[model samples]
Target: MRELSVGEAARRAGVAVSALHFYERKGLIQSLRTSGNQRRYASDVLRRIAVIRVAQRVGIPLEAVRRAFSTLPDERTPSREEWAKMSAAWQDELEDRINQLMNLKEKLTECIGCGCLSLTACALANPGDALAADGGGPRRWTPG
Candidate 1:
């Protein structure tokens, strides 16, 4: 099977070698060593790097990403079925986050019409906006 050196892998992944090393250190990817004592990675590592970057963009920490990857079999490359399942899980999480953000937007939009009284009841409200002087920030008035 084809393998990539650390530099080659990083170049193909469009990231710096140091970043690749960091990812390996963080358990986001794995590498094997050649007889010459140099790092080598399976060519499929490109896909893993892509997944790691996408997970990070979606606000998943490296630890969480590692844990998610741990659920997959490590004997061989992940099959299409495994990829589909993982992608589905991530999609569900993204959908839930989107729903939450939309809910917040709806609440803020409501505040514009409700005389901003709900601002006191809303936890996401900007604490410094007109309520800081009165100590109505999150510290003093916990959201319900």
Candidate 2:
């Protein structure tokens, strides 16, 4: 079987070599090593890289990608059925995120209308300041 060098794989994958290294480190992709300790990747890795890039573009997390890839064999590209299954799993999360963004966009006008950024009155932005009770760290807003 033919194998590609790190540069060749990166070029074919349309990503930087550093990104490939990072993916390998993150367990999203794998590579073999030559006797000279040079990285070599199977042709199938190109397809895997394309999938990873698309997933990331659509806001899928690396952990999610890793989980999806864990179900596939390392020696081959993911089949259509595998891709469909992974995409279906991600669709729910993507829909939720879309809803959250829409909600936030709608609330943005209200927030601007009320100049006072008080948590008490700005229930749309921060309901009861519940995040404050968590501690003195950055508080993330969860979509209701």
- What local lDDT score does residue 45 receive in model 1, on the 0 to 100 scale? 82
Residue-level lDDT of model 2, residues 2-89, one tens digit each, is: 9999999998888999999999999999888999999988877887888788777666677778878889877666688876787676
lDDT of 2 at 3: 93
lDDT of 1 at 101: 57
Q: Judge candidate 2 at residue 31 and give its lDDT.
A: 86
- Report the Cα lDDT for residue 86, model 2: 70
Deviation in angstroms for 1 in model 1? 6.0
How many Å off is the CA of 92 in candidate 1? 0.9
lDDT against the true structure, each candidate = 0.75, 0.75
- Model 1 residue 42 CA deviation (Å) reads 1.2
Off by over 4 Å in 2: 33-37, 57-60, 113-119, 128-144
